[model samples]
Target: MERNFMTTTKPFVIIGAGIAGVHAAESLRNEGYEGRIVLIDRDTQLPYDRPPLSKEYMLGESSESNIYLRSHESFNTLRIELKLGVEIVSIDAEKQIAITSDGTIIEWEKLLFTTGSRLRQLQVKGSDLEEVHYLKTLSDANNIRSKLDNVQQVVIVGAGFIGAELASSLKKLGKEVTILERMPLPLAHILGEEMGEYFLHLHQSKGVNVITGDSVVQFDGTSQVEKVLTENGRVISCQAVIVGIGVIPNTLLSDEKLDVDRGYVVNEFGETSLPNVYAAGDCAMWPYRGANIHIEHWDHAVNHGKCVAKNMINEKSAPYSAIPYFWSDQYDHRLQYFGHTKDWKSTVLRGNIEDQQFTYFYLNESDIVEAALLVNQPKNALAVRRLVKQQHPVHTDLLSNPDMSLKKVHLRANEDKVSY
Candidate 1:
């Protein structure tokens, strides 16, 4: 498709106002995009940070006020038309326009779909019972928190980050939390089975009742949820239930305009198959290395937004390449992971995890560190991130020594950057 018309100063429209969308809007203005910028989201609240919806905000350790991405004044100052509570039903790629739910026709020369992801709901019997909940928005979190006081026992389905964090939060609030996961161990698929066992340790030590390798088959109650039925015919009575199985890409509107393969297919520059129609964050499957990968990490969203924004304005697109990173907070433990394991074949253990402190490194066949994880060690997480960024081979003997400084990765970075 020809993008010759995209250079015009016509209005630019962004769908969804999550972290990726908000950052893209901010980046546009920062890159001297003085054109009319219209951002529409189904959410009424000014785009807010979502990570806290399952963490401190849900635990009452933090307030919703602190979770907002930007002040209302800033959006106004940037001349951004922030339209919330508006849903776009269809897109006309040929006409370069969008038809919203309320029959509003929005024309645009260029568009960005940062539609993000939505919760994959429970499809079991009696799943629609009142008191059974799913956390994806601030409103949902508020509803969950409002009922926490009266609820003593809660059943949480799935053991992903959201479920695990909520379980940790509820347990800290003096509520009994029973987590049910169909997988054998928590976070096994993402963090590896060995590290998955560590995640199990984190929640189990906190007194949260974790039931793995099983799923809730039914949420039973007359009106409000009072009991949960597992796939194995085990019955557990609880005052409420939280289903956090997973999420699906919110790409229904852009199906006709973009090629959908796992997610809206995008090049390394975040430009979709359609000219000037770019995608980023959770809804975009952008090229990494030689293949496309769909990432949902907060850091990836921020970086993708900034990179795509720059590419949108530049005459020549620059390939977006950045290592993925994300952190999880559970109880008193803070776990941080950097990079994805693909080329890596060997795992090196750094600290004594049995002693409640450790960092693991995933090394490729060439001995370059491909991924690093810091458990209960926030201070060293930055070092691992830098090591991944540098992509330099590590001296295994030194890296495995607990007494050796993690900062040694910096020296390796310097050596790798310099050519002989």
Candidate 2:
């Protein structure tokens, strides 16, 4: 929904002012690109990290200034031109021009569409109530905070990261929280039923109401949220609500010619169908291990931005093959995951899921470490990430033995070799 058209072609232009976009611009400068750079976004404020919005920022654990991507002085010193709060209406690849809602044309030799994603809107009734909210921007967090007063209980529709993190934050603030999820258990589809059950218990232990296999069909109130009606006819009374069903990648400017799958399709280099035109962050479905995936993880976004910036400057840059990783913070637990295993044949359970501190590894038919989730055992992630990246075989005994040296796991590959 957002950027400008320039008559004279600039050196580089980046769409979206989120983490990926800002990193791309900074990478370009770091790579010694002295030409003019333009960064555009719909936000009036400078680019700030989004991960904290649902956790630290919303809980008042972190301040706004602490989350800023970069200082204003740095941007000014780099001679970077920032066009904020502007909507890019359309882009004409034929003429290498982008038209903005502000009736301006900006042309660039290289254009990066790190356009990010828009929060998937709830289609149910009474979703437009003043008390209902979706967190995507700093303003959204602020608005949620502004309504915290007098809000006795809040109904959160989706138990994904955002909903889970926010639920934990709300509980800390002494607010009664109820989570409604259509999935059998929270994050079940992604983490499998076993680990999902662990999370279900994690929330239940925190005193927040966790309801699964049920969903909100509608909200009822007189110009304000009063109660949420579930599909099963159970009504949850609440003063406020937050919906985190999921998100749709912002691909309004993808155009007819560009390949658009679940997201804007891009190759290993992060280049779109159009040359010198790139897409990064959550908007691009990137190639990984003979598969195309749109990983909306914050770490993946930052890496994509950095890789794309390099490839945009020099065509011979290395292809991006980094394994996708993501983490979630809820209460006292920190859940960290490495690689993708959306479809795996076997899941090797390591550590104790009951204790809420463990590592679960996903293996294919051949027993390769395709993906892993470390529950409060992030110390085990580095080895898992390396193992997945190197495509090493997984011996259940090694993973099963908790006393085994995780740091020396990589050494097994070279233990028998002599350097004579």
Best candidate per lDDT, number? Answer: 2
**lDDT digits (tens) for residues 188-302 of candidate 2:** 8999998888889989999999999998889999999999999998989999999999998899886768888878899999988887789998999989899898888899999
Residue ranges of candidate 2 with Cα displaced over 4 Å: 1-9, 413-420
* Candidate with the greatest TM-score versus the true structure: 2
Q: How many clashes does each candidate structure show, in the order listed?
A: 0, 10
Cα displacement (Å) at residue 98, model 1? 0.8
Q: List the residue pairs that clash in candidate 1.
A: none
Q: Tally clashing residue pairs in candidate 2.
A: 10
Question: Model-by-model lDDT, in order?
Answer: 0.85, 0.87
Spell out the clash pairs found in candidate 2: 2-87, 2-88, 3-88, 4-106, 5-104, 5-105, 5-106, 6-105, 6-106, 6-107
Q: Each prediction's TM-score against the native?
A: 0.94, 0.96
